[model samples]
Target: MDFWQWYVRRGRIDRRTWWLQYALPIGVLSVLALMADVALGNSSLESIATGETGYGPIVTLVGLLALPASVSSGATRLHDRGMSAWWLLIGLVPLFGQITLLVLTGFLRGDGGPNRYGPPPSAAPTAGPYLQPEPAPEPDRPPYWG
Candidate 1:
């Protein structure tokens, strides 16, 4: 599916998609925004990175701009894990909320086949992020009754 179509948040996505397509872009953009914030004298990178101060305007704006994509993409990952999008709310909790959601949506494996959420996402990047996973070929073996 196209990035615009995936942005609607209606399907499942595997870890690779969640990482490469969603998380990676968001992270890279956020870093660029942080550099802009520093250049604008809004906040120092060391201070923000050390948690002495929160991110400044540019970073915040970039994060806000990316919020919908983040939420929807995260939901798709949750769907791939065979859970509903509501699970994204876990990020609302203090401290552990975001951490738990990160692990659940980013680290764990998704359902191995077609699930309630939909078929598994494509393993190949060129085929697009959302496609049926290729079926595994059977292994060579002796006959059961031989």
Candidate 2:
């Protein structure tokens, strides 16, 4: 899938691509945030490593900017699972809700075929013409000499 479709577009996304789309940006931003904290020299590596407030507003701004893409991609992933995108709002329920959403998107598989969202992300090729089974050979005579 294209870059835009993977992150911004409102379409179906299989579970595998969902993790990639979700983790890649978050991981990059986290690394950049840590680097920024080190560059400022206002905190220790331990603080940055633990995600403490060290880099100031840069990390916050980047996180805010990345939010829409994350939410949109997550919504599309929910669609692939034959669920409403609004289900993502369940994450608002605190720790349990977050874990629930994680399991739904990460562990569960999407619908096997086209759904209300669209065709499956990894659709199998259409079946070819059916081949008839070969006829079984006749049993050999038990005793031709008889």
Candidate 3:
């Protein structure tokens, strides 16, 4: 699937694919969080801590990288439900939005087994119609590398 299409499509990703999709951004964020904690310590009060320089720029950069992936993840989740990605805005309604997003994230609808997004859940094991078929195996020769 293309990146955006993969991002959409109903249902929680199987563990393997989920790790591939989220691991990098999450790992980077974790590293950044670790660095922030090391630099700033875990002080609850902001006023008493020694201010660290140069972290602002780094934190901003990491946030920019992470935010798009996060948005993509959320949008894809909505797409999985056959809903438009814009529905992610439901997360903007204060506590209501939080509850809505929680319900949406916890939902497990599986694209009704496949609609415009791609093949049905049962068909996922086979190539979806959009895929190009592999060349037939040759009896007299090794398979084509191209």
Give the per-residue lDDT digits (tens) of candidate 1, residues 65-115: 899999999988998889988999989998899999999988999988878
Give per-model TM-scores: 0.75, 0.69, 0.52
> Quick one: ranking by TM-score, best first?
1, 2, 3
Off by over 4 Å in 1: 1-3, 46-54, 123-146
- Clash pairs, candidate 3, are 7-76, 9-80, 10-80, 113-120
Which regions of candidate 2 are displaced past 4 Å?
1-3, 41-55, 124-146
Candidate RMSDs in Å, in order, are: 8.8, 9.0, 7.4
lDDT of 3 by residue, 39-69 (tens): 7644322432455433444455666666666
In lDDT terms, how accurate is model 2?
A: 0.77
Please tell me which predicted candidate would have the highest TM-score against the true structure: 1
Error of 1 at 138 (Å): 30
Error of 2 at 42 (Å): 5.6
Tens digits of per-residue lDDT, candidate 2, 17-114, equal 77776757677986797578567775567775688755556666777777877888778889999999899999999999999998888889999989
**Deviation in angstroms for 138 in model 3?**
16
Each model's backbone clash number: 0, 0, 4
